[model samples]
Structure formats: structure tokens, C-alpha cells
Target chain A: MKYNAAFNPSGGAAIVGLGMTEMTREYSYSATGLAGIAVKRALDDAGLKKEDIDGLFINAGVTNAISTPLQTSLGFRDLKLLNHMNAAGSTAGQMVQFASLAIQAGMASHVVCVFADDPLKPGTSAGAAYGGTSNRSTGMASLPASYGFFSGANTSYALAARRHMGLYGTTQDQLGAIAVSTRAWATMNPAAMQQKPMTLDDYHGSRWIVEPFHLLDCTLVSNGAVAVIVTASDRARDLKQPPVYIAGMGQGHPGNPRQAGYENEVNTGARIARDTAYSMAGVGPDDIDIRELYDCYTYTTLVTLEDYGFCEKGEGGAFVEDGKLGPGGSHPTNTGGGQLSGYYMWGMTPVSEAVIQTRGQGGERQVQTRDHVLVSTQGGILDWHSTLILSPNADAGTRN
Target chain B: MTNQDQAVRPAPIVDESSKPFFDAAADAVLLLQRCNICHAYLWPFREICTECLSTDLSWAPSTGKGSVHSFVIMHRLFHPAFQEDVPYNLTVVQLDEGPRVTSIIRGTANEDIHVGMSVSANWHDVNGTPLLHFEAF
Candidate 1:
């Protein structure tokens, strides 16, 4: 891929703090309240006061519960930058990317990126929050819903997975390998929700939500919040925790026309985002030691691995069939069990894990070689994509 | 459950941009938006041509033939209206005109549906509203 000079935000910023609330299916607080706690925790983690944070970037989940008012609710005054971003799962990486650029441009010194949601409501099924039809039953919106195409992401991703399976012969067991491997990693992480050992048989026996997707293939529905503080790389060295350098940042939004010859279902925006991120980081896929990908579904992980060039586009199923992504495997992906088994805080699930692993704070789940980590966040039905290459070494990549 | 107690299935509430499509559906005709300037076919009803940004568009009758591009068997009940239709085939048909439409495939079992299977557009009624569906050919 050709390198673009204007896209270089490498080594300009670093994550200095991380904060998260307990992941749970029961709702204990509003999304704003959770965000406030997370921001406070992050400030304490970074050993900084609330006054030190001049920038705030907020991303709300399905509920759209958290927004710009979070700054005021947190008693933040005179913030230099404050914006609510929503690129779906890609918002976290987009927040970090914008924070890096803003810090590099001298717009703000310390920025906080937070995502919070309380999608799990009382007396509702786990899928209800996401399954509800928000679209008006009129015009083009009603067309899909009128035909029993109700569940939003579940239906869309199942269709995409089916297409991939049809085109490339991807099997159900191949997808099960992802769920099993991610579950294995979840057993090691204390913060993970599903720590019970899961086997391929367990995955196969799981109830089918959609034809191509088993129940285990879907992510958990948790109510929680995650926050990270970003600042200049030079200043991060003096912070309380080891700085996770932002080596590269890139985003891609490839609109789906929902027509033939478009191929958005199989060919995702991750390919374009990967090229930009790899170019900015001055490293190839071989250089990364850990992959903290956004695994909203098992098929997502498989397709992302292929899109990131870990394997050929159509060969992801065969590549992961041998348990390569589990513990003690060649490739350590979703080291924190990802959103599937981990807390589903959207993109923050992968971003937080990448930061933890890079800072050597992963405890038992940490990879030995944590020099370089690749974090990916996908939004919509593979429509939006963002990639981040984080490293322990501040000088790992070429400086702008 | 009695018929009156059954949940009502959702029907398309047509708007200005999609009025013509639903109007054509009432006559059992599959109509797609086409740009007069670029002659590009648009799906899901669009005001302007995506290729040439031309607003001079009109609905034209389609060949009503296509192939199943992809499909899924929805096992879980996401909506109460479709309670009895669990494990039904929700298919995406790739029209020969180059656009894809989401509809249920009739006259075939869920297991029988496969990619590239030939299908033709057909109309079904929901609460007296006509909706487009496909039947395997």
C-alpha cells in the first residue's frame, strides 16, 4: 500500500489512563452516571485532577444515553474540545485518532475518550434492546421490516456470514473455533463475563439465534462504561502508568449500496483501514505481536483476521480451524475474550484490552511479546472501520 | 390463538419517495427507481442517482427475476408479529437488474434455499397492503 504523508499521526499521542465499570446484565446506574464514575477512575489512574482534562470525546452505545451533557454532568468547565462521536463500534478508535491529532496540533493537552451504555433493561430479553425496530414503518424503512427482517445487526451480519460461507465454503465449525478460542481466553481474564470453559461441542450445541450464527456467536449484553485518557507521548512518560504509544491511527467508511457487484458483505472497510494504519505505523502485519480485534460475532473475528491480512480473504475459516487463536496458540487474538465473552462496551472492549496488554497490566492473560499491538474497531455491518497500532516503545514507528 | 388475538404483521407505510414503488406493488409489478440522465437503476427508492447525482428519476417495471445472493434462517423471534414464522428463510435476492432486494422466499423449504438459486418476484398482502416477495423458480 502506498503511504500518504498527510495521514501520519504516529507516535504523537499515548494512552495514559484506563478506567472501567463492572460489567453486568443488571442495570445499577444510568449511562451518564457510569460514565462519570469511569472518568473519575481514569483521572485517578492517570494521577491527574479533573482540571487537567481539557478535551472530552464521548461515544454512546445503542441507547444513545450518553452525550455532550456528560461534560457538564462531570463538572467539567471550559473544555477546549467536546464532541459526541458515533461511528458505531469504530467510535473508540476514531476518538483516539482525533485526540491524537488534536494533541499534535496543540489544540488540547489531555483528552478523555469514553463509551458508556445501559442497554440491558429490567424484565427484557438480552436481545430486546438491540432487536427493537427504531426505524419508522414507512417508505424504504418499512420494506425490510415488513418482510420479517426485524433484528437489526443480527439479521444483517447473519446474511453477510451466509454470503461469505456460500462464496468461500466457510463452515459452522470454522466459526465455532473462534468462539471456543475466545472463551478460552475469557477464562484467564478475571473481568471477563463468561469464564466457564467452552468447547467446540458446546459452541455447536448452543441455541441458534440466526441460521449461520449460534447463540455463542453473538456478543454479551452488559451495562457498563469504559474511559481512556490520551495525551502527548512525551508527557506520558511521566504519568503513573506505562504509556501505550499511539503508533498509528486510521479509519475507513465504505458505504454499503446493498446491490450486486458491491460485495460490502465479504470485502469490508477493514482492508482500507488496515492499509492506512500499517502505512502510518511503518510496519506490516508480521510486525504486530497481538491482535485485539472487535469481535461482535465469531464471523466478525474470522473476517477481520482475513481483512487484516493475517490470512487470505477466503481462507480465514481454514486458518482458524486449528485453534490458532486460543491460549498457547501462534496468534493471540481477543486476548481479553473480546466482546463475545468479555464485557460488551462496544469498541472500548478491544481498546481497553490493547492498552492493558501494551502496558504489561494484563496479569495472567498478557502476551510475552507485547512490543506491538493492533486494535481494530468495526461499526455497522462492516460499513465503518478504524484501526490503531499501539506499542510500549514510544519510538517504535517513524515520527512525523 | 384467535385471529383477532394474533399480532398484526407490519405493513409498508409508503412515503413520497417510495410511493410509486408500493403503488406498483399493488398492481403486482416490481418497480425500481431509474435515473433518466445516467440510466442507472437504484434500489430501496432513492431521490437522486447515486452515480451521477441526477434527480430526474422515475420508477420502471423490472423483469421480476433474480437469483438468491444470500439467505438466513431466522430461528429466534425478534418480533411478536412474526411469532409463527420462526426459522423462516430471510433471503436477499440479486436482481438481474443489478440491485438486491430483501424478501422471504416462498414455495421452498429453508434448507432448500441456496446462493444463486433462481427466483422471481411475487406479491403478498399484509393487512391489505401489498408487499414484494420471491418464489423459487
Candidate 2:
């Protein structure tokens, strides 16, 4: 009994609206200002009012830690079903999963999934994320920290890259291609952070921050918010625009925090999540025109090609070369530029891209031909990953 | 609470869940692994036993004996904070009690560290606190 999004599929739930605020490193507005802008735009896109909303999904950072109802914040007294999930960065994908489950369960008529930041307030530091330093450790700071094996996210990635380079013989150029293609994709996106086209030489010439990984391989954090609205598929047809049917979605935690980011789980995890989505949408990986794996870093996208079953393990390094993940290639990942160049709301862009691809509205960055696109969500440093399958129409899994 | 000194700040510190280990480290006697079901040797201290998974674990003294299971030279510094310690030795020493303890292989160059070599624990007290480092037997 394969669970399809149509049979047990979340057919009723559809993303009817989307919204986002500008990404800025400096504080132009408070996090609430960014969150309000995004939430307001999503409501506007859905053609719905503040009082019309029944549920809210809020994430916290400098721009977003507060979990308040829309009515309370915007001067209304009639909002219900508030859901707050705090993931490191994969808040967007996590919110979608929560919303889908809530909507499918008939808990809310309208669900708003949001990612906003308030984590960067003045008089405060980047906290534990700068390093693997967590407030929740009783194991006595070990050699990994005392020896400085991992002082920050950059160093942690460096440690993992060393192992990956040692194990799979992944080349520096292969890593650069991941950065290059994302920057190329970012060139097509107007709202992207770094939209300039970069060459392989440019990537090589870039300053090497950590060993193997250069400056281009890292993600930039900004103060902003991105939001989406979901309603049942039944109401999707009656909405102001076409709906991108919720095909399949799943999430997972990493077995090893230190080594999880390099697991290349895209093949195993994405395969299962996709099988469910394809099982629901009645399509397969061959039917996909786009592949959006959560790419917080360059190696992330590189390792997942094999993880997503696009190629065999140890082949992702080679398969990524020569315009493979590029626009003309079979799979175009990070079309919205990815975290490397685009707005990274924790796999948010890919979710929006899936909607855009299915609706055939990804202006300038649209794939020539596509259907049953798979969107992946990351939990943190690849410590966890999730998958969601989307399509233009309803796909109920047929009993074989 | 206030740091007025440039080199160091003199402030009374408080401890909640980690006072005992600190005191034991002050004694230079490493005690981490614990057995709830049966009293035995342990290296890495935890509330639950890896052997029994029982929540009843108490830290005890160790003989400070182990062997190197695997090691990495790390020609590159893992942290800018430890830049002076570049090319540091990192190893997974399988304790005599069977718990693998991870630590820096000090008093030896990176190339000098080898697998299956006999090793003993050496706790380097930093800031009046013992930070675990190891030496070859």
C-alpha cells in the first residue's frame, strides 16, 4: 500500500500565495518589519485578509523569534491555530510539512508558513551557529572543540570536506562547479543575493576561506522573511490562480552531526520521499524536469546528485561538470540561485521554484519542459533532510 | 561579572551540572565512563551506560590506559583559535575499558603518531581546568 498524496495524498492542500521581503545584511528594518512585509504580501497574493487567516507558522531568528498571531500583531482579534516550529534554517520546508499535515487533518482552513529573522539583534552575537558550540552539552568540551578541530560552521565543513576528499577523491573543481552553477542560476533570478555570473576561473581565483571550500561555497545570512499560504486542493481550483498540487513530502534527522552533511543522503532520502511523491503524483525521477536539493553550501548540491539517484555514488563529482546542473542540462538545481547566491530561507527557494515550475511561472529561470518536480528541505548542516514532490495537477496514486 | 583586566578577568564562576568533573579534573584523575548495572572501567562519562543503557551512572577513577584505534595529522588547523597548533594530532584511543576516547595526541609530531600504539591519558590543566591530551606509552 503505497501512500500517495492523492489517496492518502494531501490533495486538498495547495500553496495559493507566496511573499518575501528584501534580503539585507544590514538592518534596514526590524525583523518584525520583514516578517510583516512577507506575511502581508502572502495574504495579498492569496487575496485574503488578515482576519481571514486561521493558522500561522512562524520561525525565529533576529527578524523572527516572536510567535505572535497575525490579529494580535496587525490589530485583529480573530486568528486561530498558531503553529511555531524553530528549525536552524530549514524552516520553510518544515513549515510546509506542518501546514500540509494540519490542512490534511482539517485542523485549519488557511495555513501560513513563514520564515523570518530576529536572531541578529544588536548587543547579541551569532551564538552557537558560528561554531558547533551549543548550550546543550554536558560531555565536557572535547578535543574537537578544545583542539579546535571545529571552531565554526566553516571549519566544521572543512573537516567534513577533508574526509570527503579523502574518501571519494572529490576534486576542487567539482566543488567549484556546484558554486558556479548556483551563481549562474542566481544570474537568472532578479531577487537573488549574488546574481553575477561567475566562471570556473573566478571560483578558483576566489579566496580560499577553509581548505577545499572557498568563499563562494558558503551561504550569506540576511535579515528578511519569506512566506507561503496553503489551502486544500478542493478550494485550489476555486482560488484566484492555478495550484501546484502537493505531491509528496518527508523529513529526516542525520545519524552523525559531524559527518551528516557529507552523507550524500539525497539518493537514499530523496529516493524514498520522491518514491512517495511519485507514488502519489504517479510519476518518477525520469518525469522530473527540475531537481532542487537544499544547497546551503557547494558540497551539499554536489553530494546530493548521487543521493537523489541522478547518478551513482562517487559520480556526483564528475556528473556535475560540463553544464549538467545548468539550465541546458537535464537537471537544473537552485534555479533561484541557492543559498550561495540567492535568498536562502532554508530550502525555501526550491519550494517556491517547485510551485513556479509546476505553474509554469518561473519567469526567466523557468525550465523548458518540467513536471513532477521534487523539492528537498534541509534541517541543518545536512544533519537532517526532507523531500516534497509537486506537480501542476492532481495525482492520486493508482493501486497497482 | 565585569571584566576590567586586559589579560584575564577575575570573576567568581558558578556551576550547575558540571562541578564534580571539574573538581576531578583539578585532581588530574580522569573519570568519565560509568557503569550503572556493574562497577567497571570507563573513559567518556555519560549518564547512561553504552553497555547497559541504564540511566544510573556514576563517575569513577580510571587507570589512564588505552591504545590508538585511528588518528589524523590535520596538516591544516581546524580552527583559527588554534592556529599555533597547526598540524595537530587527533586520535581515537580505545580505552582499556573498551570506550574509545577522542583527544589530541600531544608531545609528538603528526607523522610520529601510529595506530595500535600503546598510550596513556595526560590531562593538561588549562585555566585551572584539565583539557584532555594524550601521550604515547
Candidate 3:
């Protein structure tokens, strides 16, 4: 659903708590088990009890029927709101928007948004497990599979990276800048998976998963989960942790699958979503203090930088050069190492990182100004996208 | 060999909407659906026009010539049948008629393939199933 702040123009709802389980290469637990751990951690961090949670929003695609099992485990007898979303990786931000709507409408007082998955676990179907699976029996999969295009994201995104290079002279080195910078942040973050500092030489020498993409350019398939708590901005002030206001948010999808599925390397739904989010937040790109972009691939961040108006179209390559996104750089992006170096909780990785930054919990990698944080999440080869602007102040409106 | 035993690669599962496209591909012709009313080309198989939302559509033969819009050399195998073709290049061909189609770029090394390179349609037979592919023009 489209997010209209006019219903509660003063930013009524805010995220008061953020938590996560250990982000490791492999976690030995059921998907539900991990989700429960994350939910409890978020509640504990918020200093709230299980009974205080009246609503639950979860990443439905991770585990089937997660709400009932989680609610039962947490000892909540009744829930005023429940949602299970399957928008690939974009569900994290979408769930937050849904939870905020519930609180504003009085359907629930406290809502928990959670994402837990074990894509790297044993005995899992390789392609169908992640965002790149095709039906093989219908739609876009039939034609592509005939040509041996059966793998997930690595191929689809590599094609996009190559298209960008061909059209705008984006070089492989420019893409390496993103990987190198994210790894620099990961060195400071204790929870990151790929902890060893990655240099430009290491990025170039990494295994070539696809022509334009190196192994390091891709996100680590670590098994982990992250969760956050959402409640009214007024109620949040009385809670334990400081409130991170949901200043503005928006979700966008190409009107038709044909547009999203065909010739999609050049454009995506993020272009439309970013415009709405910035307009609603009353802030321009210059006003954003930091960015927590969904980094499924190095090129995804590059294209998002252009689509979100951080820089002009076809200039993201040049824009990211010279360690611009590093710790001491002007634009501090993905403060928590992001999915590329940190654990891959799909879209939740970016959301969790942004929440931590906005809460001033990002110890070493925190941006100087944690006031206006912009987070972007995407699903289905940029087919679906959502942008969220967060702040530490309840009324963080940039209208001046 | 029986159908199941002879299948070495994933074959297109034909349904009511996509049967014609596969049928034409098997005969060494590339067919793209065009809305008879809006005159817009549609990919994969759609019953109605995406542009103007018209149901009047017809199967039209394409020249099957286009430039390489983008491509990837898939080093990882997602399916058992693709193990033999590991490190093969899959390219998206921007057809001159306006729709983009995915096909394996044959007759060239994966490292040599470049975007915007001209390619023409050809047929690749896999376990008796014929499919469309492209070769350097």
C-alpha cells in the first residue's frame, strides 16, 4: 500500500527498539527459532514485555506460518494485528510501514517486525531459495531457462552491471570501490561476517561469479535474523530506548510485470519510490545524513545511488570513487558493513543497520549526523522497491 | 528413450498462453506477440497488449536480429543439466522489433562477449528439444 503521511502528518509512529541474533556464516537453528530469538531481543532492548506486543509483522517467505508459532512461543494470547509479507528482500521496509499504519489506526499498540532466514543451511534448493528463482513452467522463466539462465541474482545483476558499463562507461574498479568501502566498515563492526579487511587487490582477485561481478561483489549468504519494534512516537518517548521516528516512507512497483520483467536493466521501481519518500520527508538528497542501501550486489548500490538522486543518472560510478563511502568520506553509506560484508538478512540487513545508526548505537562506524537516515530495499531484480527516511527526533520534518 | 529419460536440459513447459511461442521456436522461428490494436510488441507470452491493454493480439515472426543489450557468464550451476554448460554466457538480446529476449550466445567465448555486439538468431538442440540461441553476426 502507498504510504500517505497526511493521515498523521506529525509522524505519530516510531521505532523504539532494534535487536538481532548473532550474524554468522551458519546458524544451527530452525528459521522460527532464530526469529523468536530476534523478537525477544528486540522486546528486551525496548524494555517491553511479550504481552505488550499486540501486533506482529514477519518475513513470510522465510518460514511458513511464522506469526502463530512466534505468538504462541512468546506467550501472547491475542494479537490485534498480524501480517506475513513476501516481497523478496523488500519486505523489511514494507513491514515497518505496515506496522506503523497499524499503530496509527489503533489496531495495535506495539508491533514487532522480524526477518529470519537460513538460505545457506544444508539441503536447500539452490535457485528457488533466494530472489532469482523462476517458475520454469510459466512467464519469464521458460524463455530464459532454455538458454541456461537458471541461477539466482548473480546472473541477473551481472547483466545489469554490464549494461551500465556499456552505456555509461562504469568500470570494474568503480564497482570495487563499493566492495572495498563496505569491507572497511565491516572491520569496525563486531557483528560483520566477512571481518578481514578487503583491499582493492583482494576484490579484483576474488572468484568471478559472473563476468562483471566478483565473489566479493556479492552479499554473503550468512544465516542470521534481525528485528525491530514499532510503536506510536508518543508512546516511544516513554519507552527504554530513544525513539527513531518514521519520518517518511514509500513503496513502488512497475505498474506491469512486462515493464519490470523485460528490459529492466536500465530502470526500476526505486526511481518512483525515492521521489515519493523525499517529497514526503520534506528533505532533498542533500539533507540525508547517511544511507543504508540494500547491497545485494555492488552494482545494486551504484544504481540505487543514481535512482535515489544522490547523484545524477549515469554518474554513480564517478560518484563512488576516491573512497567517498568510507568511514572518513563525505557520504557514509551502509554504516554497519551492509549485506555485502555483513550478514545477508535480505532487506532486513539495511533496515537493522539504519535503525542502529539512528539510535546512535553504531559505535565505530556511526555517521557524524545520525539525524536523517535514508534506507532503501529492493526485490526481484529491482522490480519492487521501498524507501524509508528515519530520524532520532519525533518531528524531524525538513520543511523550512 | 522415454521423454523423461531423454531430457538433459530443462524444457519449456507449454501452457495455453505460451504454447504458440514454443511451437514457433521449435520450427526455427522467433515469434513475439503483438497487440493488433496498439501495435506494441510483447515478450514471454501475454494474451493482451501491455501498452494499451487490448486483447486483440497476433503472433508475428521477427527478423530475430538484435544487439546484445547485456549478458552474464554464469560460473555457478543452479540446475543439474547446466553443469556441462558452467561458465557459459547468457545474453539479453534487444531485438530490432523492440522486445528483449534471453538466449545463449554461441560461437564466441564468454570472455569475448561484449554488450552492444550484433548477434543473429540460430537454433540449439538439447536432447531433441529445439531452442533459440544467438551467434556473433
lDDT of each: 0.89, 0.65, 0.81
What TM-score is obtained by chain A of candidate 2? 0.86
Q: Candidate 3, clashing residue pairs?
A: none
Could you tell me the lDDT of residue A124 within candidate 1?
Answer: 76
* TM-score (0 to 1) of chain B for each candidate: 0.92, 0.78, 0.89
Question: What is the CAPRI rating of model 3's predicted complex?
Answer: medium
**Over all chains combined, what TM-score does candidate 1 have?**
0.96
For A1-400, candidate 2 gives per-residue lDDT tens digits of 2111233233446788888888765566665667789888988877777766777877765344557654366553444567667665556677887777776776666778877774445554443335434432344534355554543556545544544555577788988888888888888888888888899999888766555567787776656778888877776666676776676666655443111122432333454455555665566667767887777678777766666677777777888877778776777887778778887666676777677677787788888676567787765545666777766766533311
TM-score of 3: 0.90
Task: Report the poorest 10 consecutive residues by lDDT, candidate 2 chain A.
Answer: A1-10
Candidate ordering by DockQ (highest first): 1, 3, 2
Question: Model 2, B85-117: lDDT tens per residue?
Answer: 665655656677656666768787666666667
Q: What order do you get sorting by TM-score, best first?
A: 1, 3, 2
Q: Write the per-residue lDDT of candidate 1 for residues A2-32, one digit (tens) a residue.
A: 1111222443789999999999999899999
Tell me the lDDT of candidate 2.
Answer: 0.65
What local lDDT does model 1 show for residue B128?
95
What's the TM-score of candidate 1 when only chain A is evaluated? 0.96
